[model samples]
Target: MKAARRALPLLAVLLAIGAGACANETHTVPAMPRPDEPVEGFDAHSPGEARIGATPADVMRMLAEDGKPSPTEHALTPEERRKLAAAFGALTPLHRRVLRERLHSISFLDGMPNNALTSPADANEPHRLFHITFRAGILRENLSEFLTQKERQCFDTAGSSRSVSIEAGTMDAIVYVLLHEATHVVDGGLRLTPGSAFTKSAWSDRTLIAPAFRDPLLARVKFRREGEVLPIDRAEAVYAALQRTPFVSLYASSNWSDDLAEAVAWYHLTERLGQPYRIVIRDQGNQVFAYEPMKSPVVRNRFDALSKFYEEPG
Candidate 1:
């Protein structure tokens, strides 16, 4: 979702050492270092050119430090690497350039809890040296199924006839995920979204938007309010509220970074790639409501800013 924050154990040790230094002397204690700041000169990768491979040890360490499950690295076969290369090759020229400059590596891990995780390769340099880890499972999935599963996470459908599904066609799931994650890389490297050009009108900050853009109904959905879910019946109302905003998806309404990433990714998916990006809602196997996000004027107008992603980089 976002770059993982570096841990605080080292700060605790520094405080302990500072206290020990003042044990027998009558002197002021040294100022405690800020916990939020990154440790100076901390680099996640050793000196080398970036490559694709199994999850590296440094990445595993960071996940462990962050209290996440340390899933085993999936050994990539020649065919798998070829598939990944094709996905990378499908990216826009700007995305390719950004990744070449800032990406430390890309990895696939077995049993990853989420589809992917992107982290800074150098803690002190948040914009550069980034690495992305994807669940190996995604390589076996199609775009429609992958996106449907992701959208499904936001609702509780246990006893309802209503359900939502995406029709993104049969493109490799890797293409969509790479496009989304690469947008994040571009956002971090260029500072394109937060409090800048993309956010000026809609988003007021990272997690909050302007009053006009807010919807009380949409606010109760999963990403909008973390760990919360609405009944499957509420799917229609949620999407109706979404159609009124500049956001491309319900997840985009969650925060500013995703707002930019989803907008750019969907723009590329639907416009440039000519893939169908439709959201279908069904009630007892009967079609009820359908939304093609890019067709919404409000959402389409927002793409004027995202044109930067397609421009030839100077």
Candidate 2:
């Protein structure tokens, strides 16, 4: 018993030192802008962000130009298309190929999407649209609003002006978030492509919207299986997946779909982005990760597994 007691202090010291190293890694990186506060000149709709919302004729028209988009897409208007066309090489051959395949392929009706803001296909037509977004995870919100200014100051005791930092750990997490979010778009059962996609002939003047899904904040996210009840073990696995995502927090585990999407996004970024990234953050002792876009061990294994799944397509 005396020997064990003597060793306990030494073990505690080692643990404390290890944790310190992990915490400092996050504080070492830079900060990013809030999600809603997008940069003015920075365009996210680059080749990587390409989405298909154009009609079949419109898509064919772009194909004639060697896969450049046509002039008449409602969301990506003619001028924007011209400006973004090859701007960042907006529609690379890869993007064009994927866009074309999705447009012509009816296989989408076989799959269902979670976290879709919209449904599939025009109730009036067979055509459909897909939306995509990118994120650099910084999980801090304006806590000052919710907490007293003194409490906020207490949270920021690390003496940083901006609330968060980019760190290696979070960058590892981003690999998951990017993939998960992109999946919500590709999942085919989103808005504009719902179950009625094949039933356009059955359309009536009265459009039906699920009452629960009316608000964006309260939207019902789709999951791997449509309407399947998630057990605690499965739900925990999903959260573990998302906890590995670059931007998730304790709050993310609140729901199953949110957890799944977060995990998927993190897994994708770490693997598919195929670029080196770093991470650095100072949690102000909050225990949150800070990541720079640096290469990471934690992200690599998770991403590799996810990539295999996508490539094999079960």
Candidate 3:
């Protein structure tokens, strides 16, 4: 019998458990005579040139080796591929540039338990070899509903009408997920956080942070605490505690890697794409609390560090 796969954490659905694990392991890459020689056969001259299709067998093997459930691959129809291409095209200039240089390909998998995952094609050369896999079901959903579903995973409703949801407004779910996952690719390629200026003030390393940025309550919730969840009754307290930290979402608090990805994605979503990222809680169909993360001064101050993503590559 195969070993049981562990439950995935919200927005922490990486192929590898954490950046620290990847950093500690050594992976072999094909010997190249020059740094400019193509790495692992990925040569997309532009983002639009990225190859899109069903998940390749090698990727499926990687997932199996990582102890992830083996999900069926989804072959894209012409129309589906076009829509995905359009969403890919909608990413920021920096995302496009970095992906064109580092991305191996983009693929879809059916029955994936998480929204999406980004994995390096060659662990030793993450910046040069990366592939992204998205759940196929998201193709049929919009941003608000998709995000609402993802956010709900952190709470146990306890069979009540009380609920928590995200209001990201109307946009293709793929666009937001792509923006988020591509940031992971860029961060891997550029080392935007984790030991860089972007994280110096708050993070000592990927999974360690300064005392001022830590919260006892937030530490006990969802991804922050492995396999643990706060009741829906604590949703307000959760968001309140989250506001005190620099993290923009509960998932971001999991580690510094996600911190950069979530911050950049939300900043791009609200500031550049003109979308709303409001978190609302409700009790028996009536609103209880709402939070617009971008409006928070504490969170907005962190945006200055994200300017590197927008700067023209030197």
Candidate 4:
């Protein structure tokens, strides 16, 4: 091992559950390797990055695409139709064409015959689906509104070259939300359950459960593909989706995997600094501390015991 890396302080995390309030737990984390490979096999469907936050026209084209699901047509006010057409009209024929092709080809999607938000249908069936439909400005508005003072502070002080333009904020926020949910999908996909490989363990008030993770990811953070135009987690991909797309609301936040996904995205986005992500820890006393996954890192928090999932390559 390199001496520079050896100089870095290690994070302490518990691999398994122990007694107490679930808060006072401490464990050890082996060093995270620098990810030099792409997560090519990850469940992330690269329907081109355009699906991040699509517009109305993009949405329509997506509806008609090959693997695309037929969206429900709500009775619109004359104003609604106008909004829809304008939103739908915003896309170039090329962009629409691309979206259609991707959605059709994607298999991880969880919707029925006519639902929108077409995800890939791989082993990682989406655990959380967030379809946010609102006026052009609402989603961004809510994000700006939803973030607590601490959240905002964290974003502002983050290390990544990732930028959050208020103007581009809506898609930026939702894309993170999507990635967050996808993280949950990845987490669930790797488990060994009945209908699925991943099953949720019943949460006893005293315990927290973690995902039984799969490879590449089971390694350390890495890029999608070398020389890829953008990282797998990018804000541009989310905002580029046109306005015609349906609005999915907050239910995406309800899942544990979703939160992890968002946290990962946040870390990747602000990953410019050597210190990557800062995960909030929920201790036995039911207290929350924003712990950087670097020095002084404590593994177990409110979510579950995810330390065992960390693997050091042989």
Candidate 5:
């Protein structure tokens, strides 16, 4: 879950187009299977599935470079591929390998909103495919428009504008979306626990989350509008509500899966990358509200839980 802050040039641009870290966890699920078992009814060619959709030559190139992506007709420009590659390079070796092996191929699409999605592949294999599509082009001008002015400002209140992309000021934004969706692939594809709370395909269902996470905040954390547009006026009240909960971002406040996804992604981005995760609000040239999750007692507790998932021996 990412947003923009006060109108600083790049940040302000982000503010104008911010849409509160858009993600829709909906997927086609056939039936319940063992966590490690192959999901039934996963159609690669079906409109609903997450196939590559790249040209045959492009698919061959991707397959030759790395035998991952299954097949589709979608085309990715060199720059888009570079961004994806850079994002892939940013992951820890462990995560990178897991994604490379478990993920079939990464697909970029046209006219899709600000979301990176994943779906299981066909056959008996447990692997999955990844898809990324922005509301506009991948460039800053296009990507920045994903959200509105007010939405990005609300997000910037907690995020450091300096930490986004130095060149385009959009890399952090792109990386966060990649990692957030990748976390889901790890959860459902690899069968990891703790963070692997949601067992079903429906992304919003918190009923089956692991006891450790469910017992604590699942019942209390309320996503203002679970599936609809959230008002800009509600930003203040909603962020204030986040202060008391273990969730790190407003998007995390959406659902259990969303909660873990945003937390895990930000944990790596801020804690590991040594980037800023500071949140502050000013009134009449004076600071009124401030919080840095890594430094805050309330947020750090949840951070500790997320840390153990990666640190403890598996």
Candidate 6:
């Protein structure tokens, strides 16, 4: 018999589960190369001259460069700006390099799709100027709400005598979001995951062509590629789905690309950063079912494939 699939509530979508726009026409590309090629004498993971925060003038300049602004963007406040800079600074040097190299400017807007990495639409613009933006207020609100609720859920862990939910906070959420978005940038820059924008033109209209990952991680996870929309009704189904698949989180089920991003983020969080991550369900006010990817063999196997990309070669 097949294992039951998990279904997350709509609220979860507000946190970190969704796909960006993709072009109608499908474009094929080779899988990410093993041991990514390094730029001459440049540390691919460190922040160099690349700027972190953007002013209104800079936002306008970026809009003009794109030929037109969305009209939805607004100036970020001092607090929001500080949080963003700190988030960028906190990233592993390697992650910092990914954003520095792939993104042109990190802008703030009132609301947009969860967050997006935009490339110039014009063909004449030879330089590949990539701009990544997020909704400053909404992002913070969502992160707080999501983490707060998770704290109530019962979780099972190894090291501790009693089980408990991981303590997730604003900074924790910020770091996760940064790594998640950075993965998108790395996906485009290194052709790390299939179906992401690479060329100057394709960048404007992103596309997610299903990737045939050589490592068979997707297959092991039992990922379905029919469409981004998932049929989920009950909260219990979410844990059921996770129990069977190797996906690290509910958001990863959206697609293979998300799977990679979510997996990488959790891997770094739990394995590298020593943060806690897990899922659980209660019955009659008692803990009954729980799943922690870091402790599962199948889940760890999928994460093993992601380690190669983030870890430096000796």
Per TM-score, the best of the predicted structures is 3
Q: After superposing candidate 5, which stretches have Cα over 4 Å from the reference? A: 1-24, 27-74, 123-172, 193-233, 280-288, 307-314
TM-score of 6: 0.58
In the range 1-314, model 2's lDDT, one tens digit per residue, is: 01111222111110000010011000010122123433333334444434433333322221132334322323444544443333223222323433333322111010111111212222222233333321111112121121122112212223343232222232222223233433433333222222332112212211222332122221211211112223222322333343343223322222323333444443434444443332222234463343332133432333332332354223
- The superposed Cα distance between candidate 4 and the true structure at residue 141, in angstroms, equals 4.1
- For 162-219, candidate 1 gives per-residue lDDT tens digits of 8899999998988888888788777766767645666877887666777888988877
Poorest 10 consecutive residues by lDDT, candidate 5: 9-18
Residue 269 in candidate 3 has what lDDT? 83
Kindly report which residue stretches of model 4 are placed more than 4 angstroms away from their true locations once superposed. Answer: 1-145, 149-171, 188-259, 272-296, 299-314
Candidate 5 — what's its lDDT?
0.43
Model 3 poorest 10 in a row by lDDT? 19-28
* Tens digits of lDDT, candidate 4, 91-119: 32322332332222211122212111322
TM-score of each: 0.81, 0.31, 0.84, 0.27, 0.58, 0.58
Candidate 5, RMSD to the unseen true structure: 11.8
How accurate locally, in lDDT, is each candidate? 0.68, 0.26, 0.69, 0.26, 0.43, 0.45
- State the lDDT at 310 in candidate 1: 76
The TM-score, computed over Cα atoms with residue i paired to residue i, of candidate 5 is: 0.58
Question: Which scores greater on TM-score, model 1 or model 6?
Answer: 1
lDDT of each residue in 224-272, candidate 5, tens digit only? 2333433333444545655665666655654555666667877787677
The RMSD (Cα, Å) of candidate 4 is 20.3
Top-lDDT candidate index: 3
- What is candidate 1's TM-score against the reference? 0.81
